[model samples]
Target: MMVPEERRNADAERGEMPVVQGIPIGAPQGGMAMVAFTTLSPEEQVVLNYRLAVMCFAFLDFLTTLLNVLTAVMGTGYYWWELLLLIFLLGPLSGLLGAKHLHQSLTAVYVGFCVLKTIAQIVFAVYFFWLWHILFAFLQIWITKIVFTFCRCLSRIPLERRAQLLDLKEVELRMVYW
Candidate 1:
């Protein structure tokens, strides 16, 4: 669907979602589904972008930890409890909470949890002297920056507008690799 630029702008100003034009969306290679990126205001776009970044990083961390655990089980004969914790904390927990935060309202609890998790990860990384831990700590910090930006953008939006922005059922990725 295509909307004229002038009409889209007018609809946005009137608190209506405008179907964005010219953005192509297709599933990635190997049949991985991609989200459609449209019907969003610029502010919503910014928030969703940050949300997706956090999700991607968290997913990567989960995969890395899972791989580590698998390798340990196959070679070292046992996986550490720490690896389990990382998988649980960074995988489903972070992703679910991130989705909630983005699709709903920004709550203090989620922000606090993110901050505490980041601090703990960094501290543990330093204590353990693990390169991967340190790398993840850096990624956590990057996620924090995105969260901060998301919070700022969300705060500037009025309550009525906020609801509309947060009501998106599926987050649209601005860039889709076909």
Candidate 2:
């Protein structure tokens, strides 16, 4: 009898091949499967990059929100409103819209938000009297830059390799269909 590894290798070699009894490998079935891929097209790579950017934005928003809340509790009160707006409104809203549209526009929105937030942090740091708040603001800005750099690196990866990295089969299917 063939071992499981041997079976998997055979399945992998079958090029646009079928696996299991009913499901064909690389067939796009919509929903989450659409995002699943063992190989990605250029367009899919763009989509993946945008998704990563959105995640980065969310992370930065969360960090800023926490900092703002802590500062407000400690009597600083300088950035509470801005941080609340970003955490409760802007970040979540943009993320929801991005998930709905799954378009490149979301990436642009995320990048714009990051830039704005970074600028806001720097300005707030200069004006704020509380040392802790200023330090947290600076840290948030640095974290945002790191996240942006990481996303840029991800965006630069070759499409074929990204597909392999993401292990996306659905994208391959979409390509076949196209």
Best model number under lDDT: 1
Cα misplacement distance, residue 169 of candidate 2 (Å): 13
Q: What value does the lDDT take at residue 31 in candidate 2?
A: 39
Q: What residue pairs clash in candidate 1, if any at all?
A: none
lDDT of 1 by residue, 31-145 (tens): 5444365455666667656666655654565566577667766776655764564444444355546545553342333455567769978998999989999998997787767
- Per-residue lDDT value at 16 in model 2: 44
Candidate 2 lDDT tens digits, 1-178: 9875577678778854554322124543753333222444454445555555556556557566666667665676555564554444465356435433443344345556667767777787788757876886777676556445544544556546544544444543566776
TM-scores for every candidate against the unseen true structure: 0.46, 0.40
**lDDT of each candidate versus the true structure:** 0.59, 0.54
lDDT of 2 at 75: 78
